[model samples]
Target: MNTPTSTHCLDWSSKPSFKPRILALAIATAFASELMAAQDSTTADKTNVQDDLVIYGGTYRNTATKTALSAEETPQGYSVIDQEELTMRNADSVATALRYSTGVNTELRGGAVTRLDLFTIRGFINYQNSYDGLQLLFNDWNLQPQIDAKALEQVEVFKGPTSTLYGSMPPGGMVNLISKKPQQDATHSIELATGSHSKKEASFDSTGQIGDSDVSYRVIGLAREQDSQADTAGDKRTLIAPSIDWQVSDKTLINFNLYYQDDPEMGIYSTLPAAGMFRDNPNGRFDQNSFSGDKNWNAYEREVTLLGYKVNHQFNDNWTLLHNARYMDATAYQENTYTSYLDTDMRTLHRRAYLTNETSETITIDNQLSGVIQTGAIEHNLLLGMDYQKLTSDIRYEDNAIAALDLFKRNNSLVDRNTLDMTDTIYSSDFTKKFEQTGVYLQDQMKIDQLVLIAGVRYDDYKGSESGKKYGVSTDTELTEEHVSGRIGALYQLDSGFAPFVSYAESYQPETGVTRNNEEFEPSTGKQWEAGVKYSAQDGRLSGSLVAYQITKDNVPTRDPNGSPYDLIQAGEVESKGIELELNAQISNNLMLSAFYSRQDVEVTKDNNGLQGKTPVWTPEQTLSIWANYDIYTGTLAGTTLGYGIRHIGKAQMDAMNTDTVPSATLMDLSVGYDLAGLSTAASGASVRLSVNNLFDKESYSCYDSNNCWFGAERTVEASLKYDF
Candidate 1:
């Protein structure tokens, strides 16, 4: 890892520069335009039509006749959340922004600082986060929502198995956050916002040329403080980030970025009382004192730093080399306390304190050679590349007191210290985990008449180790697996307005853990096959896709010791089949809509414990979401917009035993906003938005963990004033 001081140095004097030249023939042409036009008797074209739109960092684009095709077109499913959508919703966290995305589940624990928010995509959990295509690895699951949404250009979710690119990941998917980069021209903005729940925030962003040179840079910073609707837990955060780009002699470009974040804490709430417990005693409240001793002391503290550098060089036009490096350090400390109320006067006191410190360093160098070759009546775009990644996770745990206690409501406090036995010593343990992966891939795109064909293949190798506090007691293992993961697809354009395509692809994930005999286990594998149809307008104002897929996982680990939950052995298989429909369109000049629906059937195909035919826990059978926005009128209400949305989650099983379930529920949200001048001081050129969430105040329970139920948000009104410059 590079030290902070070494990463900040500038070597501007050692770089080259590019110069532009003008031709005399161009000047002469301008002078003879009128004469030449009259002689030719031809009119110049006036329509503004763009045939290609580059996505910059990625091979995909929005302008391709078919969907954008990269060097390699894998069969995995992915979604992108752009900046415009983020701004419209004022997304504060990744969970909040991706709540409606298909094949994703977000779990929010009670409290501000101690929130246990988990993100699972396609049933895979990716604990590692990435920024601008670089991985951010930390041992603990402590993630800060302080990441400024305004500083991101887009959020990409890659579904299915993805170990080929990101080494150690759950079967789910990955979330990549692309940060804003410097543009060609100067752009600056200062945004101030204030809303309900005592929310206060400020953010600033600026990007422009560096001095009088062609180089450019961008800086973004944000700070926020807010109180929550929960009992006593709120949140406070601060973030600072900056990035730079240097166009050294055109062929060589350098980009660098640095960021830091700080968050104090949040709170958590206990589960809802059991059915009988709540019905027998209507006013009997589940002990909410599970966090730290004091209501105000249940807090979480964290600090994170991310530094990355990218160097791209062009060797002629057909071949280019890209080298990227990133380093991250993150640490967190959290305290949680909750009480189990057996009755009004009897309860069990529990408190947990967690601390984690982790660091990750990675470097990847890929060389791609792309060229067109003609053979008889066919043409091909061929590409070849090699990639590598190394990831390591160091985790430590401390469990102080796991004792039970009785509580007698003394002064309204949930716990009675006189009846509880406490311990002063802390028990600690440490584990260091490391993973390494490398792959080589090749792809080609063949064009024949009106049909476009795409194909690719990749070979990968992975290895890792898990070490303990006592170094010699560690275990090491290697994963030597080769599989063909690629896509075979063809696009046939029926006309300019309609086109249909079909594709087949494969994906895989590596498993991590030791077997019953203390030997490392083999990696579990998954495969998926999908077919889809898509439609889009030539003007790019509307687009939609309907897809159907079947995915299966083999070598699933099952519990070996009869009823032992900790002993896992490979004795089961699982499969999932689903269909999804999505639409994004601008119906009119002032109206827009985005909607999605998914129906899934997932089951444990075979298991030793008679779990076959059981639905997967937390996997809802169906989900639907829609959002619509419309501008009211012109003139004084020209910028006035009204937005409404609804989300529905189908009933799902809550336990592996399949004996308990959580009912399906629907939620609604409404918002109105207007942009007008001089409504009040500090309000000129500003916009005011009013929103009501959970509008009907429906007490819906999304999930329950062992009788600890979680309820959806309550009816709440929030108003915000935003000023942009």
Candidate 2:
């Protein structure tokens, strides 16, 4: 037996270089001087330096521009899902909340793997997420952090290559989870819910000021338990979040937040053999609710803790300083048993088991200086910022062969956990990894009458090293990367409430491994071109956007035919082009509507393995969703609300060869709610709601890949009671 040792490190190669640092400083100094010189020429009125929409009665701010700009004026495409909509849909997870959003594939791994929000954006996997305005650094491990929807104020989705404002990210897009902060007024609410699969949950939210001081506090807590869709598995979770706000002066404010979550049991991440799930089998069809793992040998547990703070200081009416930071520690462990393949009989499935232990620690910080200025009738919102992020993680994996299962005989007793071997094998190993990135960026949003112009640039540097034993082999890899990303866009607004916009953006993501020739892999880079038109009703009751985009990514990694199974080479490129449309409207005094549609085409333009021109797996060609809500205000059914929704996903390729496909599916959802106050003034602050998802039980496969098929979620019914004061 051989003992394995592993270590990884990431650091700056040498002393800080002066060229980039000087350049960044010079740009900021120039902007500051121009703004100050024009200050005396113009009044300090905010409307002269910035755009205002308060008169419209509704304003939507976004992070797409690194400043407070309404979505209609941001030039790029994005979406916002507020808390009221979340309640009406009864969304329990991030993916569920985004199910009706455009350009997102939210059911990739289906319902059993709710532990992580696995999804695709614009045909590419988007694994990075942000909290507030800062990123939650994560690695390519199984230790991802999850934030409960109950503690969030809203969810924001920004599409296309977004590295100009954010340091590094996927070409497709990114998601930002906005936490519920302390409000000026006091409020309190408590809710109890029961749902399908014996699900039970309780939660509460309380916020108010600290006596008469200039301080406020808010606390949120939740507890839930439920049986998993798969047998022999279950889900349990506990979450608590506390926050405080302090207004030291009229020009300065600070906020502190703490989040903690524990999941004693996360449902199994298992898949069924495609032979029975998709193809014909003599033993008949596989049950979507069947368990593929042993009850005594399956488990997944995780715990996460995060602490963060935000500060804002106004140095006058023209300039402000903003800073934010966060620290995170998370750990996860999973033991799973899954099928490998079907036997010749098409009924006996070969099985295997694996165990994984992962832990990670991360720190991120961002600082920015924003200024509003006017220069000869041209107003500008300028931002200059810098950010740093570091992540350290350790992961260990072990595999073992398990007894086969005969689907027709229904004999699970043949497998005995105590009799299995636990010795080291060729597939067992441990690895340690560390990564760090530093970036500086500048952006300016300029407006001259009805014309808005926005341009931004960013520079990022990354360094890392990994030394470990993987697959019974010693490995050492080192990587260093530097990239400059940028974005430019222009939008023109007309008095008729129509805006036309066009933009170009670029992104680069660092790859962390070596190629077959022992050379480090190059970073994958992407470029996108987009054009769109947005319509906003002057009354602020209706808004819509239609956009078309084309994106190309190079340096994609693919299997190396001449090397071992684990070897890879950066010799592939992919292209994705799509159109997206979204609308939100208050059709009448009591009726509201939301709808989204997306159509895309993805292809491997270049590859070493005869995969060129083939469509990628898990990427559907089209998707559509629509939701509507109605309320009765003056009738026997007064205080009653009704909601209806429909979703559809087109067929998608199941393999790189495009030899098989996952059929299309359509699902419907319904909800009803009533205020108890109608019964008596004594229940003035109480209400009840019932929601049903997948009303028809739509039985189908969500996705199929790597010789496995995932079953879609079944029909679910949930009811909740709430009280507020």
Candidate 3:
């Protein structure tokens, strides 16, 4: 087994904490008592499977069960962030949109890597995303596609394993982004904004029926540019989304969509040595805004285009058929120089430059048939689904050793591309990978009075092939695997709006490529056991949930102990157990609140390395967020709105051996908005908003692995002006 050098560091332990558990149990008990007393009250009608809108403040239909299920009915953890919430927070990216969600670790790379979505959920990395229930094209390389927040209607978060409906995924769960479709009602808006770091942006959205025809159209576009914290680095983006919805007949409807995004400059996305960011150095700490790369050589360019359509057909009042499909083409080119290692003096550093050009093409399709039937007192909602996905990616890259630098000196060793010699640089890799998967699934939801039971099973066949040279080695590899996933859950809804639920689910992820002996890699499998209780007020004013879950993943690939550097063996296992609490409330006609708390304990249960029983990097033990907004309804300041939020990220281990630590950090945010219509008769549909993140500008580190460390985002301010017509 390969053993990493152990260093003297923090004594942070991975044991589960009991204080939060006790508090959650006590709160649940108190709520149960109060709810039981109101059991005599009236109850709500059963959920309609076709309802795609939100129910009970925060709910969705197609996220967890592929059918309509309210927050209090679904046997899993779920959260939805609507357009209103997004606007209130001025969220521009998916990571920022999910900043306060439960069981999610956003901005693990701090504010860098804006061109990609890189974060953790339930102690596992989950960069894959779904758009309108279809998976986006993502590969192991740098070709990440970023979806604009202005084009989304809502973002839904599903926590825990969901492989029964979705084909292949991690046990941590999935994120689904709902797009903004065409509407019959005419709506037009334009927005302009400017913020710190010379940021500038403009956006527009228009939707309406086309000349009173059966078809409606929507067009959304945005342009943005901003300077980064890293010296001589900046970002520029352009995006456009167009869609059309047609009512073919009383029983059939179709929607077509096209999305295009381009990023000409995505800024430098690299890390600094831990010696200056987390640990003490002889030369003192490094600046958070330090740049370790040559500005003239750093480059990041990307483009993504996707076209898709959705169809819904109703055969009768009890049966419906739905189909969705999308094709995506994405490309990225990157050049970056990063720190390799710090010298013994802790002031001199070695660097390496890497360059890559990659392109990926992906096609995904999903078909589902849903029906409702009743036998005696039992009601059944059945769903039969089939989904297919194919992805082909081509990548070429080169790596070269770069000149060293003095950590405390200023621009003493900058590389000039015009004068530098590239004779020593070598092309390192050129490869192509193709993957295909087909999944067939069946699910049944049965309801008998207050009890709801859900059961589902899915079978997936997946294959992968790779060819070409890898670091000077020529090879051709193929791997094919098949697996069956299942899920079962039970929930009992009481008349008082209190529901208790329990569920079990299984998931599998195929590993690409082959081992040293030319053996096909085995797929990793995960299983989870989850239980939770949810409550919704009868008045629809409040909703809350408390959940506990444990997930185990096996067949994980680890480095082969006795083989060469690039060898691997599938003999590792990991376990994650956690508890989460969430609440959303409309306190009054003019006030709203949202909050969540999560704590997790993760460990490497089995591994060939000496990392067994240790916590992984970037996995924090606890996270908490609270946000509130207030609107003045009847006063001199009646047109004003105020918002405040607090977020806390707990300590985390820096290495697989559990040595070194990244200290906890707490940040504050503030926002203000006003309706300009109240100021003058001519400004009827105008409004303005201002928001500041990290209000105190607290300096902190997001993560510090043994090699690299990341600094969290500094304070940022954004102001926007919008007009509606």
How high is each candidate's TM-score? 0.79, 0.91, 0.90
Sliding window of 10 residues with minimal summed lDDT for model 2: 1-10
Please give the clash total of every predicted structure, in order.
Answer: 16, 0, 0
Each model's lDDT: 0.54, 0.77, 0.77
Candidate 2's TM-score reads 0.91
lDDT of 3 at 465: 73
Task: Name the top TM-score candidate.
Answer: 2
lDDT string, candidate 1, 391-468, tens digits: 455544443333433322322233334443323223343555565555566767677765667676667665555556
* lDDT (Cα, 0-100) at 673 in candidate 3: 95
Instruction: Order candidates by TM-score, high to low.
Output: 2, 3, 1
Candidate 3 segments exceeding 4 Å error: 1-61, 418-427, 515-519, 558-571
lDDT (tens digit, per residue) of candidate 2 on 345-438: 9877787777778887887767777888999989998988887777777778776778887876665445566777645867676777777777
Candidate 2 residue 474 Cα shift, in angstroms, is: 1.7
Model 1, stretches more than 4 Å misplaced? 1-53, 56-76, 108-117, 138-148, 162-172, 269-297, 316-319, 337-379, 402-427, 469-484, 516-519, 557-571, 678-685, 715-718
